[model samples]
Target chain A: MTKLLEANNLGKRFGQQTAVSDINIHLSRGEVLGFLGPNGAGKSTTMKMLSGNLAPTNGQILINGVDLLEQPKQAKAHIGYLPETPPLYRELTVREFLVFCGRLNLLAGKPLRIAVDRVIERCGLGDVQHRLIGQLSKGFQQRVGIAQAIVHHPAVVILDEPTSGLDPIQIRDIRHLIREVANEHSVILSTHILPEVQMLCDRVQIIAHGQLLFSDSIDALSKQMHASSLQVQLANAPSVSELSAIAGVVSVQTIADSTFRLHYQPDNDPTERLVSLAVANGWQLRQLVAEQHSLEDVFMKIVQREENSKDA
Target chain B: MLNLARNELYRLFLSPLAWVILALSQALLAYLFLSHLDYFMQIQSQIAAIPGAPGVTEMIVAPLLGNAAIVLLLISPLITMRLLAEERRNESLPLLTSAPLTAAGVVMGKFLGSFAFLLILLFMVLLMPLSLLLGSHIDLMQLASGALGLLLLIASFMAIGLFLSSLTRQPAIAAVATFSLLFFLWIVDWAGQSGHDDAGWLGWLSLLKHFEPMLQGELYTADVAYYLIVTLTFLLFAIRKLDNERLTG
Candidate 1:
C-alpha cells in the first residue's frame, strides 16, 4: 500500500480566527478514507488545503512524494478535487466540460478524449454527454461534477460533501460510483453522513471543533458498537447487591420494582448465570435482551468525551 | 494556459452575451461609419478648395476608429466582467485554482481570451475604412497607426476590466467599477486643460491623451509606452490579487 497523499501538522487561520489546526492525514492507493465531522468543523477547510486550492498557514502536504508548497504544479497534477459547490461551468455541455477539465490537468489529443470518454462512461454520464450542464437534473449535474474530477485519472480524488444535496436514489447511485472509483484510485471524502462512512470507507477520522478526536479502522469503530449492557425484567427481582455479585456483571441499576439494568463488559457474559439463579431461586425471568449501541451513539460519545477532556 | 484560454473562449461563445455584444456593436459602429462618410462626401469639394486640408482618412477613418474605441470601451466590461467575478460568485474558481496552474497562467489566459474577441471587433471596424480604397486614395499609414492605437487602448481596457473583475465576486459590480475607472481615465485630461501648469500630470495620466496622438496619424514611442505600462500594471495587479486569494482565502 503505497501512500499517495500525506499532510502533516496542517493548520489554517483566517485573520484572528483559527479554522483548522494540528491536522495530520494520509491516504494510500486503492483505499477510501472518510472524513467524518459535523458542519463547520473545518472539514471543507482541510480539504481545500489538501487539494492545493488554499495554502495552509502551517505544515506540509506531499502528493505522491512531492511537496505541495515547494512544487505545487507538479504535486497538484496528481490531485483531483471536487469542491463543495462542484466548480462547474454551467454553459458548457457535460462532455465539453469534462474535456476542458482533462486539458487543465495536462491531458491532450487522443489521451484527453479517451480519458473524458472513460469518465463519462464510468460516471453514468453517457446519456447527458451532449446536454448543457445547467439544463440537466441536479443528479445529472452532480454526476458531471464527479466526472470532471476523475476525468484526468489523478492518483488522489478529494471530494467535499459529494452527496450533500442529492436525493436518496441519487445518493445511492453516487455512492455506487464512488465505490467503483475506489477500486483504482485513492479517495478522501469529507461527509457528515454516518452511514455513508460505515458503508464505503475502510478507515474513518472523526473531527470536531477544528480538531481530530478519533482515527481508526471501521472495524474498531464497530467494535465500540457491540453490546455493553443488558435490560432485564424479573418477577420478584433480586437485590441490586445480589445482581452485582454475579460473576460477569460489573454494576446494577434499578429501573423499577421488578426491572433492572445490568452493565457488563463486551467479552464477558452473565446471562446464563443469571438465568440459572432465576430458575433455582424461583425468580421468574420475563424479558432479557442485550442493549445495542448505534453508531450515532458511539460517535456522540467520542465527541462528548473529547469535549469533557478539554473542559477538565 | 492555452487550454484554459480555449475553454474561456468556448464558454464565452457558447453563451448569447458575446454574440449579441458583437452584433450590436458592429451595427452601431457601421451606422456611425457610413454617416460620417456621407457627411465627408458632401463637403469633399469644399475641403478640396482649402489647401492642405485633412484627407479622407482623417475625415472618415480616424473618427470611425475613435468611435470604435468608445463603443468597445462601453462593451469590453461586459466581456471581461464574467472572466473572474462570475466564476468566483458561482464558486467555480476552485476548478482553475485547484488545477496545476499558476496565477499568471489563469490571468493571462483570461486576458488573451477576451483580447482575441475585442481584436476581432477591431478588425471588423477597420473594414469600413478599407472599403473606401475602391474609389479614393486613403492614407494606409494613418489608418494603420489609428488601428494600432485602438489595439493598445482596448488591451488596456481589458487589463483594467480584468483587474477589477478579480477584486469582487459580482459581475455587475465588476462591470460598473471597470467602466467608472476607464471613464475617469478617459476624461481626466479635461482637468488638465482647465487648470494651470501643475495639472500636466493629470493629462499624462489620461488614457485618451496618449490615444489622441495615434488617432491623429502621429505615432510616438512615448504614447505606446504609456499604454503598455498601463496594460502591464493592471495585469500584474490582477495576478497578484489572485495569488493573494489563494493565501488568504
Candidate 2:
C-alpha cells in the first residue's frame, strides 16, 4: 500500500515551549490510524501540521510523497482536516457551508455540486443539510464539519476530537460515518479515549509527553501490555489444591459452581493445560478463555509503567 | 480563483451583518450626498455673486466627492473588517486556506465581495448628483471620472480594512483598528497645514492626499497611481497574513 502521509522529525514550538518533538509517522491509504495521547501530547499539533493549518516549526511533512513545504497546495489537496473545534460557520446552512467548502477547493459546476451532495449523504447530514449550523445539535454540527472536510474528496482525513462533544449515541453515529469514510479515505483520529481507538482504529499510536509510548494494532497492544494481566473465567473448576499447583498461576477463585477464574502472567497461555488438567481431574470442562485486556487498561498500565520507570 | 471569489461574495451576502452594514452605509451615503449638495447649492448662488470665486469649478466638484469619500472611508472598515476576521473567528478560514487557490486569490476575492457591498452603497448616492444638476450642463465626463476615482478610493480603503482585519480574529478589534487607521490616514494630510515643508512627509504619505485631487474631477497620474499602489500593497499584505495564519493558527 502507498503511504498517504509521512512526518519526519515533526515538531512544533510556541515560544520556548515545544509541543511535539522528533515525531515520525507513516500512514497508508485505507487505514484508520488512531492518535491516542494525553492532553497536550502534540496530537493536535501533528494533525495541524499534517493538515496545513499550522506550519511545522521544525522538520517536514510529506503528503503522498509530495513535500508539504515545497508543494503545499498539492500536498494539502490530499488531506482533509477537522480541527479540535470543527471550524464551522454558525451562520451558514449545512448545505451552504459544504458548497462554500467545495468552492474553496476550486471544485465547481457539476463536480462541486456532486461532491457536496456525496459528502452530505456519506456523513448522514442530508436530514439537516438546510438547517443553519448554529441551530443544529452538537452531533449534527460535527457532522457538518466532517462533511466540509471530505467535500473535496481528499485522500487523508484528520479528525481532532471528532466525538468530543457528542453523546453516546451521537458518538456511535459519527464513528460509523468515520469508518465508512475510511473505506475510501485514510483517517487520523486523535482523542484521549482509548476505547474509541479500539472500536474505530486498525492501528494505534499512543503518545504522551511529546513521545510515543507504543504503536501497534489493538490486539498487539493488548498482548504487549504484560503488566496488567486479565482474569479469565472458566465453567470447569479445578480442585483448590490442583489450582494452587499450576505454575505461574497466582490464584484462582470459584465464583460460581463449576466456575473458576484464574489470574496468570499475560504471556503464559495456561488455558489449554488448565482445561486438560480439569479433564484429567474428572471436572467437566465447559469454557476456558482469557478475558481480553481493554485498551483503556492497557493504555493506563503502559503509561504508569513509563512513569514508574522514569521515577526509578 | 473565480470560484473562491464567488464563494466569498456569497458568504458576504448571506451574512446579516453584511446587510445591516449595507443598509447603514447606504443611508449614511444618501444623507451625506443630499446634505453636501444642499451646502453646495447654498454656496452656489453666493459663488455667482462674488466677482470671481478663484476656482469655482474645483469648488463645485471637490465637496461632493470629498464628503462622499469620507462617508465610504468610515463605513468600509465596518464592512471589510469581517471579510477574513470573521472567517478566522468562525474557524471557517481553514476551509479556504487548505484549498488549492492561492492566498492572493482568496484575499482579492474577499476584497471584491466587500467592495461590491460598498458599490450598492455608492449606487444610492449616485442619484444625489443627478437630482441637483437635472438638466444643467453638469459635466458628465467629470462625473464619471469622479465616480471612478471614488470606486478606487473605496477599494483602497477596503483593502486597508481587510489587511487590518486579517491581523486578528476578533471582529470588533478588526473593525475598530480599521476605523482608527483609516480615519487617521484620512485627516493626517490636514495636519500638514500647520507644519513646514520638512514636516509634510506624513501628509504626503496620507491617503487623503492621493484622494483629494480626484474628488475635484481632476485625475492626476501620480494620485491615481498612489491609490492603486496602496490598494495592491495592502492586498498583498493581507494575503501574506493568511499565509502566515496557516502556520500560526
Candidate 3:
C-alpha cells in the first residue's frame, strides 16, 4: 500500500513550552488510523501540523509526495481538515456554507455543486440543508462539519475529535459515516473513545505527554497486553491452596463462594484438568468461560506504563 | 480569490448589521443633501453679482462629497471589522488557511469584499447629486474628480481597517483601533499649521492635506500616489500578519 501522508520528526514549541516533540506518523489510502490520547496530550496539535493548519517547528510533512512547506497550496489541495470546534459560520445556511467550502477547495461550476450535493446526502443533512447552521441542533451541526471536510474528496482527511460531543446514536452515525469516508480516503481521527478505535480503526497510535507511546494494529495492541484467563463457577469450589495444586493452574482469584478466576499459561489448557478435578470432587459446575483482553484494558496499561516511566 | 470574495460579499449583505449601517448612512446623507440644496438656493442671487462667484457645485456638491468621505471613514471600520476578526472569533479561519489558498489570496479576497460594499454605499449617495443634473448646469468634470478621490480614499480606509482586523480576534477591538488611527491622521495637519513655520512631512502625512486638493476638483499625481501607497502598505501589512499566524500557530 502506498503512503498518502508522512511526517518525520514533527515538533512544535510555543515560547517556553513544547506542544509536540519528536512525533512521526504515516497514513495510506483507504485506511483508518485512530489517534488515541487523553485531553491535552497534544493530539490536536499533531493533527493541526499534519493538516497544514500549523507549520511544524521542526521536520517535514509530505502529502501524496508533495512537500507541504515548499508547496503548501499543492500539498494542501490533497488534505481535508475538521478542527475541534467544527469551524462554522452561524449566519450561513448548511448548503451555503458547503458551497463556500467547496469553492475554497478550488472546485467550481458543476463539480462544486455535485461535491456539495454528495456530502449533504452522505452526511444525512438533507432535512435541514436550507436552515441556518446556527439553528440546527448540535448533532446536525456536527454532520455539516463532517460534510465540509469531505466535500472536496481529498486524498487524506484529518479529523479532531469528530464524535466528541454527541449522543450515543449520533456517535454511531458518525462512526458509520467515517467508515464510509475511509472507503475512498485515508482517515486520521483523534479520539479518546476506546471502542471507537476498536470498532472503526484499522490501526491505532497512542500518545502521552507529547510523545507516541504505542503504534500498531488493534489486534497487535491486544496481543501486546494479552492475559489468558478463565472464569469458573461451581456449586462448590475448592480452596485457593487446593486450586493451586491443579496441574495447569498458575494462580486463582476468588470472586465469591462459588466463582473464581483462573490464570494459566498459553502452553497449557487448564479447562480439561479443572473439569476432571471438579467432577472427582463432586463439585457441580455451573459455568465455565474463556475471556480475552479488551482494548480498554490495553489502553489503560499502556498509558499507565508511560506515566510510570515519566515519573521515574 | 474571487470565489472567496463572492462568499464574503454574500455573507456581508446577509448580515443585519450591514443593512442597518447602510440604511442609516443613506438617511443622513439625504438629509444633508436637502439642507445644502436649500442653503444654495438662498445664496443664488448673491453669487450671480460677484466675479467668478461660488456656484451650486462649489457650495453644495463639494461639501456633500466631503461629507460622503467622512461617512465612509466612520463606517468603513464597521464594514471591515468583521472581515477576518469574526472569522477568527468563530474559529472558522482554519477553513481558509488549510485550503489551497495563499495568505495573499485570503487577504485580497476579504479586502475586496468589504471594499465592494463601501462602493455600493458610495454609488447610492452619488444618486442624490445625480438628481441635480436635470435642474442646473452641473460640473461633470469636477464631479468625476471628486468621485475618483472618494473612491481612492475609501480604498485606503478599508485597507487600514482590514489590516487592523487581522491583528486581533475580537472585532470590537479592531473597529476601535482602526477608527482611532484614521481619526488621528485626519487631524494631524492642524498640529503642523498651528505651531510650525513650515508645514513639513507631518502635514504631508495628514490624510486631509492630500484629500483637500482633490475635493476642489484639482487632480495631482502626488495626491493619487499617496492614496495608492497607503492602500498598498496596509494591504501588505494584512497579508504579512496572516502569513505569520500560519507560521506561529
Which candidate's TM-score is highest? 1
Q: What is the TM-score of chain A alone in each candidate?
A: 0.82, 0.81, 0.86
lDDT of 2 by residue, B218-243 (tens): 78888888888989999999988888
- Candidate 1 lDDT over A16-93, as tens digits, reads 899999999989888899998889999999999999988999999999999999999999899889898888889888
* DockQ of predicted candidate 1: 0.76
Q: Which lDDT values do the candidates have, in the order given? A: 0.91, 0.79, 0.90
Error at A290, model 2, angstroms: 8.0
Going through the candidates in order, what is chain B's TM-score?
A: 0.98, 0.86, 0.98
Across all models, the iRMS values in order are 0.7, 2.1, 0.8
Judged by DockQ cut-offs, the docking class of candidate 1 is medium
Ranking by lDDT: 1, 3, 2
Per-prediction DockQ scores?
A: 0.76, 0.47, 0.71
The per-residue C-alpha lDDT of model 1 at residue A150 equals: 85
lDDT of 2 at A80: 86
Q: What is the lDDT of candidate 3?
A: 0.90
Better of 1 and 3 by DockQ: 1
Off by over 4 Å in 3: A225-300, A303-312
Candidate achieving higher TM-score, 1 or 2: 1
After TM-score superposition, the amount by which residue B246's alpha carbon in candidate 1 deviates from its true location, in angstroms, is 1.0
On lDDT, the leading prediction is 1
State the lDDT at B234 in candidate 1.
99
Instruction: Report lDDT (Cα) of residue B229, candidate 1.
Output: 98
Report clash pairs, candidate 2. Answer: A55-B247
